[model samples]
Target: MNKIAIVYGSSTGATEAVAEKLQSALGDADLFNAESVNIDDLKPYDFLIFGASTTGIGDLQDDWEMLLPKMEKMDFSGKKVALFSLGDSASFSTSFAGAMYHLYKALKGKVEIVGSVSADGYNFDESDAIVDGHFVGLALDEDNEYNETDKRIAVWVENLKQYLN
Candidate 1:
């Protein structure tokens, strides 16, 4: 099994909760808070799962904003990456899960990006995370549909397991 690390940035703890669930689901994975993670801490991991909650007007969560420049500079050539984000589609329809897009743009050409989820069940006006009719990562609308989060995460993680292998 590959060494996996789940790193996340959360303001209201939604993304962190998801990360915890992922850590539990993926048995041997490590979990880290984005604010405290050092670049060197990620070197041992072959796979990375990043989670964040979208903030004001399509912005990444505060911790992610601080880490973006470092992430952009890091070499992710042989690493595999997956992304997930928490957003409110009902309130922020135009920018739902936008932080995931920011992460995707930073890591796209550098890493083997995985975990693109279907956008079929999502009701959003617009999102930069959408590519070729699919979401670039797992999208969670906890504010509007909290009940669906667990199911969505479970399904997405299962799909991600295939990609990770």
Candidate 2:
């Protein structure tokens, strides 16, 4: 069976819910909470979907801090990587999707950008769309005053399902 891993960090279970939904949608998936996961156990997976809930002024969740240094030092060549982030745009306007931005830059390898989502909004730039793959973003709740954020995510994820099949 093809192995896909969903490694995540969640504070209020919002990100966890998102991850579970994605995992169920994918089928044949392994879900791991970042806090209890060991790096060595990750070797069995062929693809990775990494998610983190933003904390402490646009930073990674507390449990994820220890793994950053380790992830920075390892190699992910020839691996498929998808990134998702949970954050409050209202609190940190400047760094709305900081965790995903930083992780994408740090991980070394042939990463196919799966995309990033936030509580603010996302871009559906025709130029940014990936033909053979998909880029997506989704909000955790309807708290976004403008209400445009969640709509974009739904659209993006619907587009993403095409590639998954």
Candidate number of the best TM-score: 1
Q: Which stretches of candidate 1 lie over 4 Å from their true place?
A: none
What value does the lDDT take at residue 24 in candidate 1?
83
How do the predictions measure up, each by TM-score?
0.96, 0.69
Instruction: Identify the runs in model 2 with alpha carbons over 4 angstroms from their true place.
Output: 73-75, 108-112, 116-165
As a whole number from 0 to 100, the lDDT of residue 136 in candidate 1 is: 91
Which numbered prediction scores highest in lDDT against the true structure? 1
Poorest lDDT segment (10 consecutive residues) of candidate 1: 156-165
In terms of lDDT, the poorest run of 10 residues in model 2 is 123-132
lDDT of 2 by residue, 1-165 (tens): 447788888777877877877776666689999878888777877677787776665577666676666675455654567777666555555555455545555663445655443332333222111223332333333234335534454554554554343
Model 1 scores a TM of 0.96
Error of 1 at 158 (Å): 1.0
